[model samples]
Target: MPGNLIHFRRRVRSVKNIQQITRAMKLVAASKLKRAQDRIIAARPYANRMLSVLNSMARRIDPAQHPLLAQRDRERVMLVVVTGDRGLCGSFNSNIIRSAMNFIEDEAANRTLSLTLVGRRGVEWFKTRPWQVRHEFVNIMTRVDHRYAREIGKGIIDYFSASELDAVYLVYNEFKSVVRQDVILEPLLPIRRLEFEQESDTDPGVDYIYEQPPREMLDFLLPRHVETQIFRAMLESEAAEHGARMTAMDAATRNAKEMIDQLTLTMNRIRQASITTEIIEIVSGADALEG
Candidate 1:
């Protein structure tokens, strides 16, 4: 009984220590989530308007005039897969990897598939697989920035322009809320003009007066549009990862606390039983002496 009490005390102490770590991690993750969420909120509007304008412009112009508007056979394809660099965030990494694999498998049936892995988790997983990894951006999530996205987006644009890649797609976790994240697969290249018409908030019937030729405007805007898209995706993934970590750590901390409470209760019961036994033994000794 005494040993059990001692063991329970040690267990409770260990759980309390673990709970403290988890609580600290939860707080850190929540702080990061807030910052990431703010960044995403600020970035989305500009990106959306720019994309709307570009798409609107693309529809009015000739496809031959702009490389980005060129629609080609998807015989060769690349997927920019985004994942978290670290783990312990529940199913965040696994869900991304699973979705990517499924997409690769489906695409492999009809065309060539390659991956441009972003984040360490993606790099590690794809490197061990049979798929071809075209590019890698390790630890990019540590600091999500437009410059890093621009570099990556430029490479992708170059490949598409050179006819090395016919199509490019992006796969990532879209942050919807603190408790919900959605896996999103978005087509990046061959800008389908019609898709944007549905998403546009502006009047589709209206036209814009351009200072430069539409072709020249496209030359400048198309590349930057792609970069903006990549940046937005990075921001979304970072925010989602932080949310997942925050939620997971909070649950862990709560579980640890529950465990500590149960252990403490058991220890108290054992201690109470030991005291009762001692009291009974003393009473019997007194009776025997009196008799």
Candidate 2:
């Protein structure tokens, strides 16, 4: 029993150490989640405005007038997948990867499709797959900015402009709230203007003059718009990852605490049993001496 008690003490100590690490991780995740969430929220207004502006411009421009707006029969397609670089964030990475696999499986007949991975996890996940990887960007979730997004956007635009790809799609996790995120797939290129008709309906009653020709403005703005959207998606995914990690770690910490409590109770009971046994043995020996 003493040996059993000693072994249990060792186990309890190890679990307590793990509990401490998980608690620290939970706190760290919470701090990072707050910052990431704030950045995502702050970026939304600018991103929405940019989308509105692009939508307005796209509405006025003819498809034949701008290369970016031109729709083609998709002979070659590109899937840009965005995910976190690390794991331990519950089902966040798994959900995105699973969705990507489903997408690939659904489009398996279309063998001309290429993949563009935006995070280390995405890159690593698809590395063993038979799909063709056209582009990859890693460490993007660490600090996503417009410049990085624009670089990626420019690559997509250049590829499409050069007729390397017919259509482009982006898969990412959209942050709905701290507790909720949805995996979303958005068509990025062949700049679908018809989809923006609902957005046009909500526009304020105002007209603006274009400095350059509308077509010329679109030529410049469309690529930047794509970059901004990609950056925003990265930001949203980062925030969602942090939120998921925080929640998971918090739960793990709580479970560890509960387990420790149960184990402690068991240890106390065992100690009490040992003390009672010792007392009973001593009393019996004394009685035997008296007899």
Candidate 3:
């Protein structure tokens, strides 16, 4: 009984230590999440405006002239898989890896699809797979910025221009809220123009004076638009990563507390039972002496 009590106390102390670590991690993640959320929110307006401008320009320009806008028979496909660098987040990395694998399996039947992994988690998960990995970028989540996005965007653009890959796709977590992040598998290449629904109250036609030819504007705008999309995805994934870590740490801390409570309760029960037994033994000895 004493041994069990000692073990329980030790376990309680271990759990308390774990609880403190998890609480600290939770607080750190929360702080980072706030900054990430602010950045993503601020970037949204610029990204949306860029897309709108791209759509307007794409409608006027011929697809044949622009390499990005041209449609091609997808002989080869590239999947840019985004995940977190570290673990301990509930299912954040697993969910993305699973989704990407499913997609790769599906696409393997028809197209020769390759992977471009971002973050150590995805890289480690897919490194053993049979699929060809064109690029693997690890430790990228720690410092995500427009320059990183631009570099990735430029590489894909160059690949497309060189006719190495016919199509490109992006798979990442899209942050909806602090608690909700949905896996997004979206096509990123051949630059499809999104059609907007005309509002009844809006003007029939709106015109803008162009400083340059629409084709020239599109030549410049299209690449930047792709970069913007990549940048936005990076931001969303960063925020989602922080949110997931925060939630996971919070849950871990709570579980540790619960374990400590249960252990303490068990220790108390054992101690009480030992005391009662000792008292009974002492009373029996006294009675035996009297006899």
Better of 2 and 3 by lDDT: 3
Clashing residue pairs in candidate 1 (N, C-alpha, C atoms within 3 angstroms): none
Q: Alpha carbon lDDT of residue 259, candidate 3?
A: 93
C-alpha lDDT score of every prediction, in listed order? 0.89, 0.85, 0.87
Could you say which candidate leads in lDDT? Answer: 1
The worst-scoring run of ten residues by lDDT in candidate 3 lies at 199-208
Candidate rank order under lDDT: 1, 3, 2
Query: Candidate 1 lDDT, tens digit per residue, 169-243?
Result: 999999999988999999999887663435355655444677998778888999999999999999999999999
Candidate 1: lDDT over CA atoms? Answer: 0.89
Against the hidden reference, what TM-scores do the models get? 0.90, 0.90, 0.93
| lDDT, candidate 3, at 162 | 86
Clashing pairs in 3: none
Candidate 2 colliding pairs: none
Those runs of model 3 whose alpha carbons end farther than 4 Å from true positions after fitting are 194-210, 213-216
